[model samples]
Target: MVQSIVEELEPLFNPKSVAVVGATTNWNKWGYSTFTSALNGFRGPVYPINNKESEILGHKAFARVTDIPDAVDLAIIVIPSTGVAAVMEDCVAKGVKAAVIISAGFAEIGKEGKRLQDEVLSIARKGNIRFIGPNCMGFWSASSDLRGFMFPLPVKDGPLAFVSQGGNVGGAVVTSGFMRGVGFHRYVSCGCAADIQIEDYIEYFGEDPEVKVILAYIEGLVDGRRFLDKVKKVTPTKPVIVLKPGKTDAAAKAITSHSGALAGSDEAYEAAFKSIGVTRVESPEELLDVAIGFLTQPLPEGRNVAILTPGGSYGILCAEACATEGLEVVKLPDRVIAALDKVFPPRWSHGNPIDPAGDRNLLTYLTAPGKLLKVDEIDSLIFMGFSGFSIYTSLFVSRESGEGAPWISSREAFREVAKEFTRAVSLKDTVKIGQTILPIVSGMASRMGIYHEEDVSELTEIIAAAIVSGRLRVPFLVSAFLPPGSEALAEMGVKTPPTANEASAHFLVAMAEQWVASYKKPVLTTTFFTVDQPRLEGTHYAYPSGRHAARVLIKMVEYKEYLDVSQK
Candidate 1:
């Protein structure tokens, strides 16, 4: 039965030909958006089915689905609720295997809407046609290049497959994943779930070879028992990360109105997820964080963790957060402590949160994790700050403002603009602009002669170590260390012309570029401390906060625990 559902959804995701029912030439309508989006990425034949228009965005329009000359494997129905039943009938007559209903005004509205939804579902079921939604934004597929989504953003192809009950939430997750270097294999917003429930998507994604991690933003469930059953089979092999909202009474009511899904008792949902080995996160941010962990890092053998930080405060925060998540910050063995003592300065914290107080040596950051991971007590490790590599890059890009430097009008003007540059990175366009500018800067910066071959080799050694750890299946995570901010740059700003540090800065940036070239993965490290900067490419992402890092490690440990028990 599970195999049958998986086979049925195959055409829905990678249909050879698609017809957009109720497609229109009008730019404002939902029909037009879905039609154009379908044409953008979907390489197969796309027929626009519209009675009113002769053509849509250049494709010849058919008055009805049955009128299309070729068989339509999938139909995207975007007309009003009153008109969807007729389209379904036409789709059935034309042998449409699957559909995604983008039009709203269905079960989410009230009794009349529910009746309309039932009518549509009846038609679809009778025809053996499975559909996605009565009110969904749409979906995207990396395999078929299908851009069936409402808003098409540049998405990277990776191992994460996401299913969301809410359309807007699904869109947010996709866009956020794109920015943070997290990629998706597929994305679906299953609204109303009149025909195809969330469990079907989960079951299919679990079996898919392309998908390594499954993420869902769920408002509520139609059948808790079915969901638990479906997820139980998937969790032992693949990680299922979910963010289920509606914990409060008011939010529970809202969930019902939003998707016509009953927000079942939050406690029941929590206990079920825990038992089934589902990693439930509180917010969207944490959902992505945990997903990245599963995709990049290995599961720990136990809950014991080691924290390494340049500052004592970050170490303290991570330790506290680890405790809250039921993860242990294990005491370092005497040999491990003694090994680190030789590398760190005299002021370093001697305990588990290995705080090398005021140590700016690059070698310490690269070598310390090796020592910790070697010990039997430590199952995982988290580094709290950016590696010293970023400091050199920050110094490289920063130049002092002279009286008439063309880059800025004055130091005061530079300060204001610098602050704005930091602020601008939050927007999508700014990120696009930064992506365009990075390669250009990299090209010019590469010409600068090598500053220190020894430093470059040491950084290379760190990358080599990371690759080895991943090969050996050791879990390691690091906090995102951003470039210096406007304030720091201003304080360090010089008034003279370009000095010898210019060479040093270029060399530092060269070292980073070398790191990126060797790593050969998508830039997971944020460049220039902004979204626009080149990400430090590595096997694992540098997390934004200690709490996020701690939570991810705990979940990884929990998953390992489940596997341990289940295997026995």
Candidate 2:
């Protein structure tokens, strides 16, 4: 039944002719953007309906929906909330099958508003009219170029499918996606959701062949059972990332009042997410980061991570994070260690968190990463260093004070060495390598005598460039949750902390490690930050944060051991 609905909605997005009710000549009104953008973005025929205006945006206007010369497949209603019922009636009379109502001030307002909402739905039902929203901001359909609302910015077509309960959040997600090199296949802003709900969009995105990853920003779940059912069906084939807000009592109250929604117990929501295999996210950034990872990197089989860094401190922090996430930081074998030793200074660490040190030239960088890539023991590699190494040749040279200006000569020598090193590290590897390029100028300037200000700035810019180029070559997985049964692995010696942020990072690494171990595939990794900690009100209650961690851990377990094969 659900599958049939998804198929029906697909064409609405790719309609042949669209009628815009309440079309206005005034550019200040939403009618202008909605109508104009649709005409520009969508290549289909557009009919503008407005009794007051002869034309809108240079297109002849019809007096009413029924007056349109031909049968329209879709209708976009941007009229006032009070007038929507009448417009819908016209749509029914004209035999418009699908509609997107971008009007607000309905169920989200109050009981009176809800009555008005029900009136609109009643009209649609009687006419058998399927609509998207009464309070939604609008939606963008890449395949059909169906732009139905006044989105502030232009959106490029891509594979990511995004749905959000909050219109503002949806817009923000679309905007952020543009900056991060992410693209979208479709975007639906299900505002009050008086008609078509969140689950409907979820089901649609799940079944969308062109959409490889689905992202949602939800404040409340209207139907838990149905949502879970769809999640169970969708997650194995594609990655679904959800960012849900309003966990705190005060915040939850505000959200409920704002949307006129009954945000169920956060604990119940968390349990539902886990039982169905949904990846719960802490922030908007985390949602995007994790989605990017799922879109780019392969699902990891197990939770064993190998840390590779340019500095000892960074390595230590990564190791601590791995331990907290229950990932095993196994020691390198003698053969692996011997290979690294040949390229590293005596002062460099010989353990699992391999640090080649500051003085190590470009040859050592290439050699160390190559050695790690060949070792079967390491599941994935995390490279941490300043962005300076990526761009400036001078940043790699050691300072030399001499009348002969030996530093200049040294810099040239290092450039040759660095080029060779960059090429080696950037080359494809059987094991996944994820690199973190820190802003070096700021760090160096903060250190009293480590580097001069000019040198620091130059190094920072250089490393930034290198980091950008490296990212282009190596696909990175954002943070992901570990599957269940990770608890058993935890019992096997993996340790995780109680904090959600730390737990999320740890679980991500563990999942990456587990992936390499189980599937013999390389996985790249990254992290997202969060400060949220929701409380559990009862024994049966679950903290949203903890539940999120559990979901990630369970995913890892499933990926590694095939514990939950039904999802696959």
Question: Best candidate, lDDT-wise?
Answer: 1
Report the C-alpha displacement of residue 11, candidate 1, in angstroms.
Answer: 1.4
1-568 per-residue lDDT for model 1 (tens digits): 4447668898898899999887788888778778888888788999998898897777889999998888889998888889999999988888899999988999999999999999999999888899998888888889899988665666778899999998887888788888767789989989998988888899999989999999998888878889888989999999999999989999999998999888888998889998999999988878887898787666778878888777777778888988999989899999888877766777888898888887765445545665676667877777666533444433333333312223444557655644554343334243433433333233322333222333234334444332333321111110011122333333434222233243333333333333334332211221112333323244446676567778888888888898898889
Q: What shift in Å separates residue 119 of candidate 1 from its native position after superposition?
A: 0.8
In TM-score terms, candidate 2 sits at 0.72
What range of 10 consecutive residues in model 2 has the weakest lDDT sum? 534-543
lDDT of 1 at 182: 70
**What lDDT would candidate 2 get against the real structure?**
0.62
Candidate 1 whole-model C-alpha lDDT, 0 to 1: 0.72
- What are the lDDT figures for the candidates, one per model? 0.72, 0.62
> Ten-residue segment with the worst summed lDDT in candidate 1?
473-482
